[model samples]
Target: MLDRDIAAFYGVETKRLNEKVKRNARRFPNDFMFQLTEQEWSLISSQFVMTSRMKRPKKSLPYAFTELGALMLSSVLRSPVADETSIKITRAFVAMRQMLTFSTLPEKVVTLAQELYKLKEEVNEILADQNDINESTRAQLDAISTALAELQASRSQDATLKNRRPIGFIQPKEDEE
Candidate 1:
């Protein structure tokens, strides 16, 4: 279960929930519960948060309890509701693990999805670059075509001028009388 959703289920503020775990720190040994690193937190945040949100505000993400930690938490928690919820959570975790074991495709699907996302980004970047290059090439070709058309239109006038020139006006031989 996601930390946020778990927090909501326990009917406590996420900070207060973390504080309870912090106060009873020894129950959560390193393996039982661990704080998410900055990178791990960011990845989780990106996964959970909506893309439309402009910025993801950073927060002190707390230690997440594993199965052992959650069971230990059930013992320490003061409320009956929390204890009951913990049992349910534990069962859910077990069920999820079982489901994962049953499915061979889950791991492969995740890997393939990550690779596909990377490839899509690369392809989009390449297409944007290609579009820019193509536009420039088209503009250059249009300019060249316009210049050729103008040169062709002027060729007849130049030919007429050459034909109109008198032969006497042509340069005389050096020995002419």
Candidate 2:
């Protein structure tokens, strides 16, 4: 998380939070907190829609605190509100960790794809076995099969996109201009 975000959560100004971090520098190692490089900041800004404050000009890059660094903040900030906010932050971190450990979205998507494939196969079999089918009925069955194929193709495309990493910014082709 960013220093400004942590300060907001703790009900303190960003300057004050940085001050506290500086005073207790020994508590936070390089891994616990670090400043974002200009390149990293630019990439992140381009990839994400940030608030006005974040987009504002600044002399230096903002500090990013790891979960341990955020936890260390509670010790440095001795206010009741800060303490309460720290507890919530800690809980959020724990929940995120747990969710990561037990995530099933990919598995669920695979299962759904398998089921759709099976259904498609069954539909195809039914269409093939229908010897006495009228023209309208055959057309309807063909439409259903087409729809299922399109749905499967769409799902596969979505899965591929989801797995692909996001590129923050791309230059437009000169030919397009």
Candidate 3:
């Protein structure tokens, strides 16, 4: 997670969050919190749409906080909101671990299964809508093709008519008339 996101979750300004983190730097090891490289930042920027205001010219890259670092932030911030948010974040992390390990509670497993079914149904509906769009697009393309062919034929006929000589004798130029 980026420090800014964690700050937002903790209900603090990003600069204030960084200041707290810096104050308690000993709590965050290099692995827990580290600055992103320019290359890494560029790659992330390419993958996501960043706001122009967020694009500041900084001497150093923004810091990335690992789960441990995020947890440590709650302790450093010293606010009730931070504490509650940290607990929720911690629970989320534990839930993710449980899901990955396949050690989810029975109730959680049932909920997950239901959610999966809902997702599957949604995907099927989207595919059906896409098929309808495909058919409509095909019809439109055929109409365009027919129109182009007609236009081309008309243009060819006009060209031939323009190039053809008159049935009678050639008319004199304006100067001769």
Write down the RMSD of candidate 1 (Cα, Å).
16.6
**Highest-lDDT candidate:** 2
Candidates 1 and 3: which is better by lDDT? 3
Error of 3 at 6 (Å): 0.4
Weakest 10 consecutive residues of candidate 1 by summed lDDT: 51-60
lDDT of each residue in 61-151, candidate 2, tens digit only:
7899888899899999988987898899899889998898669777888999999999999999888767546676889999999999999
Model 1 lDDT, full chain set: 0.74
* Model 3, span 114-170: residue lDDT tens: 999999999999999999999999999999999999999999999999777656777
- List TM-score per model, in order: 0.51, 0.55, 0.51
Clashing pairs in 1: none
Candidate 1 clash total? 0
Question: On a 0 to 100 scale, what is the lDDT of residue 27 in model 2?
Answer: 95
lDDT per residue as tens, model 1, 1-177: 434556666777666667778799877787787887778766766785464123323555545667777777666666887888888988988998998886977788999999999999999999999999999999999999999999988997788976664567566455466
What RMSD does each model have against the real structure?
A: 16.6, 32.9, 23.7
RMSD of 3: 23.7
